[model samples]
Target: MDFRNLWPSLDLIIDAGPIIQNQGNRNGSTIVDLSVKGEYKIVRDGCAKDQTVKILKEFGLKEIHD
Candidate 1:
């Protein structure tokens, strides 16, 4: 209520509750760091870790563990 009171002329104020997702099975997308040559840092797993690993190996890139 305080927020609205401060901004009486506000046009939009979304709650962000309706579009939230807690979890999902499939990997949204693989995020890998390719800064080091022939090496990769698995920043995030996408389509599951197995699939992401396979792709890295195919590209002759080794995963760096941190």
Candidate 2:
């Protein structure tokens, strides 16, 4: 059964309709890794993977992959 109608009343949902439609809430903004010092990871590629890498390198931040 189609569940799109319930989205409006649902408290939480992971529907990808918005994402597929290019209407994401964050517009692909990458998030910073603040758990460690002097290191970083791309939590979300968002819409700026290239830009994120450029800034990370400019600041000499090490990228860690877990």
Give the best candidate by lDDT: 1
- Give the 10-residue window scoring lowest on summed lDDT in candidate 1: 13-22
Identify the runs in model 2 with alpha carbons over 4 angstroms from their true place.
1-27
* Candidate 1, number of clashes: 1
- Model 2, span 1-66: residue lDDT tens: 998988797553322233322345346455556456778787877655556677777888889998
Considering only N, C-alpha and C atoms within 3 Å, which residue pairs clash in candidate 2? none
Q: Candidate 1: what lDDT?
A: 0.63
RMSD (Å) of each candidate, 1 decimal:
12.5, 10.2
Cand. 2 Cα-lDDT: 0.62
Cα distance off (Å), candidate 1, residue 38: 0.5
Residue 58, model 2, lDDT: 86
Encode model 1's per-residue lDDT on 1-66: one tens digit a residue.
356565776543323223223355544555667778889897876554565577679979887888
In model 1, how large is the Cα lDDT of residue 46?
57
Pairs in steric clash, model 1: 27-47
